[model samples]
Target: MSPNGSPDVQAITRLVEEVKKCVEALALPDRRAALSSLRSAISVLEDPEEAAFAQIFQSPIYNFAIRMGVELGIFRKLLERNGTPVSAADLAAECAAEELLLVRIMRVLTAIGYAGESGEREYVASQLSKAMVVPYLEAFAVHSSEHSARAAIRAPEYFKLHGYKTPVDSRNCPLQFALETDLHFFDWIHRHPEKAKRFNVCMTGNKLRRREWFEWYPVAECLLKPFERRNRNDSAFLVDMGGGKGRHLEALMKSFPSTESHLVLQDLPGTISSLENLSSGIRPMSHDIFSPQPVVGALAYYTHFVLHDFTDERCRVFLRAVASAMTPGYSRLLLNEAVIPERGCPPVFATGDITMMLVLAGIQRSKRHWVELVESAGLRVVDVWVSPDDGDMEGVIEAEVAS
Candidate 1:
């Protein structure tokens, strides 16, 4: 063992080396399976009881340190100072923070690999510290500390009040109870535009999405090739229902520029406005999903990560609205979502499922949930094709107008 090595250090080193080796085997047939298995094995080997115990003891302090780091602008300040190391005294003077508290927080950050210790009492921005300035992530961290985490603290009481059942209404979730608000999630977002802006764009970044719908969705067979031969009229070839900023649509248009598919994007007005530089070929329409869909009888109506934000009752409304505009036997509705397992969902995605439940009163459904949803909406599930379980969130549910 190294002179300064502890069990935690040894564990982390093994974890990193194991990850590197597993990643190197990606060219093999079971790359996904290999990665999945590696992840499972790592979960046990990486977090031995000793490390878990240490984590439990250290987590509260870690949270406090990060919260203070975000609030006091330690990350931003350190980044602005460039590669130069800053002493605690200098940082406290600049940020007007208490010197002792600032030092403690900085120590925590450095210990956690967020920053680098330079000299005896000075610190320099590490790569992770520099990355912290990404606006959305910082915003999310702030939002978590300010909001959802607080709601989580009240979980036992909120659950008891709600009969220990899953909340199905945004206005009645644990967050609503914690904040003592009657407003639904979207209404609350509207009232707080600053938070809404950060929250909405968070998913658009590469961080949230593992793969694109076109990677799994039968875009070429379902929409593009049909569009290539179909008559081009006022109606768009594909209506990207609730597509935020048309990222997928943009990729489609770029991928098949010559295809006759005219792209249209329908989303809430506020979300649409952020697409000021929306590509020329795509049409942007401010339309609510609950209302009747204005674009009718398109080749396909595509939705990405949208339905996961609504309860089944609300989802039915959305589905029926889109269904109303579909031409029987001709139009298709493609839903891009995460098909969480009935049980033992991966930890990364389970967090998302929980967030949807608490924040939007929506759900991350399994295959059973998808079938019920489609059948309830007066549609038939033609196919539920999933990508190679890159173990990334994968679901591309295709439905057509009921016969």
Candidate 2:
């Protein structure tokens, strides 16, 4: 084998000829029919659209039911009595609500497989429903409901008053609209300290649910491993630029304990101050990355679910600030954002992109668009790793300072 103790040239030539024959056969009429049959058989294995639509549309109903159940302490009540199937009338009596209203909501949940109906009026908690009984998951439902309410309340006013043409009018971003109308989400919640606490609890709940996905993060593991092995003395920092309340950092730390990293939870002053007593090992730093990132000397800077919140210009500014913080050779940047597929990929991210656009004048980027953004910020893309399960919903792009 060309002096490498492998297959020789003649053997390689013969193998290539055999492969060419196979390729030629794939083009033949009978082989084409076989290929078509194989594809049809594969499609029967899973109906993707049926699963996706159910997930996207029915999720809100399930979330709402969970929130209502938590509010009424239904799960806790059931668990106290060892998860016995209780009557709707009894549940309503306990919560001092109308039985009909409670049953209607329960019916929606039962249809979606969250709860189980026992005979005519009785209900039993399913495993999924039991999972929602946890304090964190309950709080998450509340938080999601709060955001939904905020969006609903503002949508009509935003459309009529501001001459807002669509949900994603560039003039009125979600952050700007929330700030203008609600005077910032947390700011309003700050007045009610209990609500603020619930908000944090809800944020933490989302982290708990999705942190497992990080283990499957291909590029994050690949890029961070080198630093963990090489740099023994200095703690390599992962500056989570715009990391909301250090939830992502907490998740990352849980997943990668050896990767010595500190979270720089950057946000608005009001948002930062509210999260003063978050927890140990999380240094909540207040700095607007859109202005100019103050803290430097980070090993690998990270931005997750942040870039899609801003317009392209603002995204450029954000990236430039990250670039400015980096020392040429050492620091690397990691972007955990969706890389919108060109054509053949699923429509989940595309639909998400539309939601972002409608809600906050945000747009998801394609790979080429991301490349442009990276290059524009004086950084060059090293590699991109897409999750096999998630397609491009949570892609990791490793970038370094451009030479």
Candidate 3:
């Protein structure tokens, strides 16, 4: 009940309590049912505007909370302590952060259901928070926060001051701008070792999620099967252009162990240098695909989630480079990306298109758009294969260099 003693408030409170009970009951046996119930409760409690606002505002708030967690070394500390609860003051002391700041961050986390506050200053990690603590997932948190902060900092000046309508209206987008000013993302991070380390940690953390996708889709295996049939000396190479840190390549190797292949990881000079200590079967090369692709005579050139990062013109340049670097016959170009469907599709990919607009001036393209883009690059779309478990927007598109 409200302190104002409103009957409507009392009724709503009772309804919310009832919904919670229903959620708990449904959750015991089936999580999907519980989630549906929770969604229903939200719909009942919140009007369309309120619900939309809650959904959108959560990204920035959650990013801020995650950034604070990273800065305070909360995940490392929690992992070291075996996921035990800790007081805010004690945590602050351990991380050398201010107690009040830690509490403030934890309070936000509690509100968002990432953590739970038991007493005045005591806090415990929740299941959701534990997921964030896992190293690979934690990288995603770090990336989200870093990208959000960079975008926010530039938003006011580039958008408001310049009278730009939206982020896309700005020249080069936030990421491209950052890259231009900072000598590209990998270059800047390389010069600043600390930032580079953080970036690596964040990227590696986020890789954990995509690693699961490989198990179901097995794009790596599918692409390598033909290569494995060839002679040992006539091995194929999965050239991951713009392959930062070879995370995808590592996953590919793990999936197709018998495929006698080499992983050619091409990126900026700085990123390539960082791979000096990388294990065997992975050859890190420093070459800008925008200039020219150096490697040739490969069985397959795999570009996973890299094409959508550029405009059609730029993507053509990239694909042209790939074509130039491949042998005429037997060589294939495999693009493992989301092939957006036109109608009756899920909202996540559509929403993802907006993020691309803000971050890199990239987009989630439909199959038609992909066909046009690849053809412009002198490549023909041979076939599109959807993993049994994958949704409409994501699939492997097999392509070949145009004659």
Candidate 4:
């Protein structure tokens, strides 16, 4: 072993130097590769016991602390200070939490670099902590802790009980097993108004992280060009199927403001009724996803980050419903989703696959899987458009009715 107890410190040091050079040259791809290598190197170099504690035990402690901090409005209070550190006593008094408990939570946050430790018994919010004040981010934390985390804990038990088979039953999956409910995940959320609203807000957070689909896809040629020549009776230009709060539709309107063709946003009745200030060009329609498509022969039917919430069997049924409505030669089915790589898949996606299995009985599909899944629904993959940006995790899969 080397002086630092790492078997390969020399290689790791070279990697660090390479990463620095890439950073100086502004070589994003090289930098990303170096960073990934560095992470792997560090994992190997780290003390196994420490790594185990950090991975299995330390994360939950920090998560619980952050959740409690959000509940007590500590992050917001820290943000209001504008980088000025506040004493534990002052923060506790303001947030109405016990001083000792608040300090313990702050210690965990500070240890994780989420909050800055300035002087003894004083703290300041980091950028991450400031970001936590956003409603969507806050909601994401709450939703994950309350729902996904619980399901994840039960996933092992669920697998053992179910003979380690992939979960495809929407109503009897890990989320239901953990929460002890029979309702489908969406139905369960809808039944709780506040939780439903938070879930919608959490979804909006995803949009902020990545480029909108229209940005990279051939929207003008594929959608607008066809809209001008389409059958007049087919007034619906685009349908945002299962679109929560119509954010994507609103985005499409902004992206192609000149188009006067119909834009419809479909969702559950509760979701549709709660929508406010939707662009007048976008029509909000209440429609069950599993039901037949009500707006027929639309230029395109778009589902954004929605499909992974279901199983292959359920998706086949849902896609068939959309396919039945397509005007074979003209209508395109746009699926904006992640396409997991067949080999060397990133940990984020691998984790997402498990999370989907646990909570939604769904999956993150590979390119092969996407083709198979789409074709299984009587649709043919036309193109998969992904951004040239290296970190873009999602893409648009353009499909149409098979000949």
Candidate 5:
């Protein structure tokens, strides 16, 4: 130990003071920015075991603790009271969990910085905690804990039985092995309505103020009719294949309300039927991507975070369908899926890839993979729009039908 207890301790003290100053100076730091800085700082300052291995080992405990907070309405209660400190007894009464047990759980919550210990026996939600209570997050946590975790926990068993060679079909993957059923991921979700809602929420989260292809892509330039011919627009400009909830189309309609080009949204019949207060701006159609493109000759066929749910062969089926219907010289295909870097991926993407591997044999493909896949489907790459600063994961890939 150095003179001041320990060098690491002193370093932490200095870092904490510096962080305090930085945060204090800012009127309001972005949530993601704050999280990024905190995570980077912790990685360097904290013990490797505690930061890495220990946390990995104890991750389930933390995940479940967060789940319990969501399920028990603890965060809702605290938020309702507007961050006012409340005793364990009051929370216990509100949630129906025993006070003593709640106290133990609250200790875990506070330890994780989700809940702040306002007084000796009271608690309040932190800003991060409030953000975590979104319906999207609740659904995600439950999905990970109950549905995804079941398959994830049994990933080793699947590996042991089937070997590590992947590129397998999603229907016959680890999820099937874990559940002892051969249904596809969507079919399984259909059987469980509640879990389907959760799945929907998670998908909705993707379209809700999150990073998307349109952020860097020229949406207006591609979709909008040239101002000179505004009165004579005929065909659909874009079709969002398997686009859930029609959120993307609706958002775009708002952005280009004056443009006369038709916007189309295509998905399953059930998805189309469930959409509420759907904007009149988008032409809704019940069509599967695997089937022939029903809305033909679209200037752009957009697919975001959709292709990863299937095997390579299934992706080929979807792409071939689009290629067959697209006008050779006019139509363009825009892929918003991840083109994972060759070097290394962020931990979140790594974990996501592994989880997808367990359930769907899904891959975040590299640029070469994207090129090969598109060419195999009779399409040629036009441009790949990437923005590393905004974490676009190799961004959007624009392609056109092969001549």
Candidate 6:
């Protein structure tokens, strides 16, 4: 290790050179890939025991600490200091916590490289910590730490008790086991209004800084041009099923301001009632995905990350409902989800698969799995548009009623 504590300075320098080369001539995805490679190279230099300890203890502890920091507005307070290192006592005062307790949190944060240690008991916010000050990011940190992470810890015992069978029932999954409740995950969240709000915020947070679906999808070629040809005459152009708070519909409306078409956002009545500032052409409807889709033969019925929450049988029921409403060749079903590859899938998505298994009995679907699911519901995939950025791992599977 170097004096600055980074491993193998010469190796890192070589990796940095590679990253610089990629950044100058490559797209963002290639640049990100190079950066990932650099990180992997650096990680390989870690002592075996250190790595083991980090995986076994440091990660969980840091996750909890980050949530604690978020609850106390520690990241925001640090950002307010504006490059000045604040003493633990000052931070404690700001957060209304004991100085010693604040110091303990700070120690872990600094050690984890989220905060900079300028002097004894003094901390400066790092870029990551400053970024956490964003509302959605903060919500994700807190929600995941408090809910997902805790439930994940119970997953092993959940599996052991169930004789290691794969979880296919959402109502009786690991989340139910962890919370010791028979309520489905969504039902449980609904019962806790505050947590439900945080969860919705976290879901929105997942979309932040990522490319919008329209950015990668050929929207005009697939939906608009055809709609104009038919002159659908005030018909719904897009129906975002299970759309929470109309975020994606808002984006769609904004993206195509000149197009005078109906954009519908559907969710449960409770979620629809709370929506505010919807774009002029957008409509909010109280509709459940499992129920018969009330809007028939829309140009496109879009569902984002919705299908991954249930078993194949449940998904089949929902898909069949949408299929019955589709207008043959005119109507389309667009599913935005992580299309997991059959082999060598990214760790982030693999981790997400396990988390979904633990919490919602959902499995991230590969292209093959998606095709099977679509066909089983009397729908056929038209085309799949994957985002060029691998980090996003999101794709839109366009499907329509089977012949």
Local accuracy by lDDT, each model? 0.80, 0.69, 0.68, 0.86, 0.78, 0.86
TM-score of each: 0.84, 0.65, 0.71, 0.87, 0.87, 0.89
Candidate 1 — what's its lDDT?
0.80
Instruction: Encode model 6's per-residue lDDT on 1-403: one tens digit a residue.
Output: 7788867778768867876675779777776787787668668868889988879977888888888889898998988989998998899999999999899988888887778888999889897887788788888887787667878888889889999998988888878887899999889988999998888777766776589999889988998888888876778888999998777887887788745458888999988998888766778899889999899978899998988888899999899989888999899999999898889787889999988988888889999999989998899998888888867779999999988
Per residue, candidate 2 scores C-alpha lDDT tens digits across 1-403 of: 7688864768757865775577664634455455555556556755889867876787767777878888887777666656678899997888777999888988887787677887798888787778877778788678656654456545666567757564433545453454465344445567788878887676555334233436666635565665655564545467777776766777777666654335456777767887745656566778787878777767778887778866777787788888887877778888888887878545556766765664556778888888888888778998776655433356777788898
Q: Put down candidate 1 lDDT per residue, 1-403, tens digits, no spaces.
A: 5667645767778877887777765754467666677667667766588778866788767777776777789889989987999998999888889899888888889999888998877989998887677766677666776566777778779899878998877788888888889888778877998877766655445335365667656677777677667666666777888887777788877777753347899988988987877788898899998999988878888888788888899999999999999998888888878787787777767887887787768788887899889989899999887766456657889899889
Clashes of each: 0, 3, 2, 0, 0, 0
Error of 6 at 195 (Å): 1.7
Candidate 3 versus truth, CA RMSD in Å, comes to 5.8
Give the distance in Å from residue 102's predicted Cα in candidate 6 to where it truly belongs: 2.5
Q: Which runs of model 4 end up more than 4 angstroms from their true locations?
A: 1-37, 231-234
RMSD of 5: 3.2
For residues 34-85, write the lDDT of model 5, one tens digit per residue. Answer: 7677888778867987778766787888888888898898888888888678
Q: Clashing residue pairs in candidate 4, if any?
A: none
Residue-level lDDT for 275 in candidate 5 = 84
Candidate 6 RMSD to the correct structure: 3.5
- TM-score, prediction 4: 0.87
| Cα RMSD (angstroms) for every candidate in the order listed | 4.3, 13.2, 5.8, 3.5, 3.2, 3.5
Q: What does candidate 3's lDDT look like per residue over 46-145, in tens digits?
A: 8899778976887677778877786677756654665567888898999899998888888888888777666788877776767777665666566655
